[model samples]
Target: MMALRLRAQHRGFHSRRPSRARDVARVGRVNPPAIRVVAIAAACILGLTAATFPADEVHWTITGQNSVTVDWRGGDAEVRYGTTQALDRRVEAVAPEPLPFSSRGPFREAKITGLDQNTLYYYSIGGGPLHTFRTPPPRGGSGFTFYVQGDIGGSLDWKHVAECQALIAEGRPDFVLCVGDLTYGNSVGQHAVDTHFNDVMRWSLDAAYMPAWGNHEWDKPRSDDLRNYKGRFDLPNPQSSPADRRYPYTGGGEDWYWFDYGNVRFVAYPDPWSGAWADWAQRAEEVMAEAEDDTAITFIVTFGHRPAFSSGEHEGEPELQGFLGTLRARNPKLVLNLNGHSHDYERTYPQGGVVHVTAGTGGSNLEEESGSGCPWRGGCPEPPWSAFRAMHHVAVRLHVENDRIEGTVYCGPAGGGGSNTNDIACAQGSVIDSFTIYPYGLKPGAPKPPSEEEEEAQAKKPAPGR
Candidate 1:
């Protein structure tokens, strides 16, 4: 398959002969104003040099699980990494094949493996001049923190992007999880994708960005979305069953995959955008079931474009409802559901178990209330299942400790305070809600495992809708 085959092309160099003094004299004699022309040429060259000397904008992303992938845009892709600032080592890696759209549309990506677990590796991308990232430790190791946000695009609110960058700088997360809808491509064209990343690079200092697929990314067709996503990011494509070379074992088909970092298992799945959630639902269930055997898999978090339950403007899609139901049925331990598409923030608790939180307000304008009967709206009066609901700009932060996992839903700075409120404008940067989940057997008198009756009750509850 084209995805698996690694094709490297070498561009042959042909040097040009240097101009000699005789040639210069001949040109000068033939010109009516050689001195003037030389002066003009020198001025133009100086201007060009000044224009090109601006601090270069650097873009790099981190992917893969135990083995991390680093890619940079706007310059050569290389790495000078080590534990100290000296960066005593250097390694050359292949640059990613050019992808269509803009000059920087498709950034290059490379995988760095054979590293120790729970150890920090400071590496610079594009060799040395610029760009760098810190590799995250494998799962079940020392605890670490990462930032999570979604639905950020180049158009609309650029300040939100700035806020996100400031948050990253403050938190200094090992990495960032951009849930989805990164580019406002749903209304625009492919060019928007490049613009989106350019905006991100402007704000992103040194954080490793990992993105999921959103519906806006499906501008042309499902295949186009896959191509653009793959072309832009370096992700793991698990070799399909030992027999099939075409389809890889990656979780969500194209952008779907699983990775471990500091006692947490992150499963990124493709949203139902390409009409493949049914198939993905089954695969995801299987992966979760197998993960049950490993006690270390304490936190099971999934990210996609659509939310299982939301109170925002686009909440009532039947397919989304079904997908959420299936996902909840399959993975009871699913602690968080990160999404982006609604352009607002919301958090919903499972009727019986599971906590469904939506961080779709990453810079995108706040979506008007759909007035649908979801938990976000007042329609449900008192949702038996929902623990907290808000309509505002915000992100979710997960802090994984040795024995417990703590989560805080952070609203935008504009939001009045760190308190929950139905007012969307007053919900920014506020600690709308906070919760913690302990290991199954670690805490005494913890809630018992849901019985079949409780599971049935959860399945029968009204799902989120438009």
Candidate 2:
């Protein structure tokens, strides 16, 4: 295979000391337009010459407020990074420890720590193309955006996945919040995982990826194992994994983790199939409780594979609903619950003080609505809490500001068989849904709910016609 190389355009090198403004400005230049120009130029160069570089499946993992873990395969054990395009700093990369009875990985991880917060750094592995990534700002920073999706990646659904990837690249988000079913490890095996890692290398070039586990990540009954899924992707808080009663298994490394990006406390709750669902639920609540006490945290968002309430074919998970509803009812800071597993797009009407979005429309067999009663912890009407439902491949981009959270759902090609089985078009990508939610309460200048006595007096008053 031919290899591509990106030389540092600027040759100036700075001292050990770093300048925040200079670095941040350089970081802003890594936007989509500049990247497109660079990619086109690289393509032209690739047609004329080829080089041999073994590094493949390169990606970034946000490990902490000031740290990021970079992973790749078949590269020299060294990484070069710096605040400037000159790429002056260096770190030695090492292979991840092998897991017993799982896929033997040659994945190498290099954790860059103690870096400046919210600053951009350019890096390269073994003299490869220069890549860039931005560290998240301090906890209360609130101007960033990220993408969320799940049930992504399949051999047959490559077109949909590719289209979704294009949208992600164009937006150039700070990171991607992967809710689960990333590569369908149970169905497609190691090849699928590797392919996904490579496919993500492009769009995730400057964005950190945070993942939650899905049921497909664990191969149940056969080996009851998390094969390649565990071997790849370095996640935060692996040692905090709760004990599983069933197979002496602990694939909850990536599933049970949380991080504060900007003012939002993002929590990745364990997948429901983990056998220790109740324990995990308690743990998730504890995380929220902690976030609630932190003044820096303005909103809390929880995500996992299975949906607590969905209009799609799969039955709602009452167990999850019970846990999430309790959080929403008690904590006003709990704003959104993201999920997948139903294989369609659904957005609830802020049921129980939280907006629920089921974005399982990412490159898998689309599921139609099940006509069953709307499932909520305290009972909901027949039409369901779902405000919008569709059978199209889609992903949501959330713009989180200090006061409100804005979201836009972008649709892609036909999820399955390239036909519009549902009313919504499965054709070109476009914005299908848009919404805004004020985390603190009603938006500014919005009217407040009336008191009981005032409501009673208003109710007693007849209509003007009457």
Score each candidate by Cα lDDT.
0.54, 0.65
RMSD in angstroms, all models?
A: 15.1, 13.0
Q: How would you encode candidate 1's per-residue C-alpha lDDT over 1-466 as one tens digit per residue?
A: 0001001111000011221121111111112247856964785677543222222323445455445665444444456666555666666656454343443322455567765544455665543443344455555664666677787765322345556556555565666788777765534455456556656653344555677766555533522344455556666543111112232222233446666666667777674433356556666776776665567676667777666666554553456556555555555555566676665666665433455667766665555433353424435553555566666666667777766667777756553222222354444456777877665422446774663447789899998991
Query: What tens-digit string does per-residue lDDT give for candidate 2 at 123-189?
Result: 8777667777777777787878888888776433344666677777767778888777777544544
Model 2 poorest ten-residue lDDT run: 10-19
Indicate the TM-score of model 1. 0.71
Q: TM-score each candidate.
A: 0.71, 0.78
Worst 10 residues of 1 by lDDT: 5-14
Model number with the top TM-score:
2
Q: Which stretches of candidate 2 lie over 4 Å from their true place?
A: 1-52, 98-105, 155-157, 221-224, 238-241, 245-248, 369-382, 415-420, 445-466
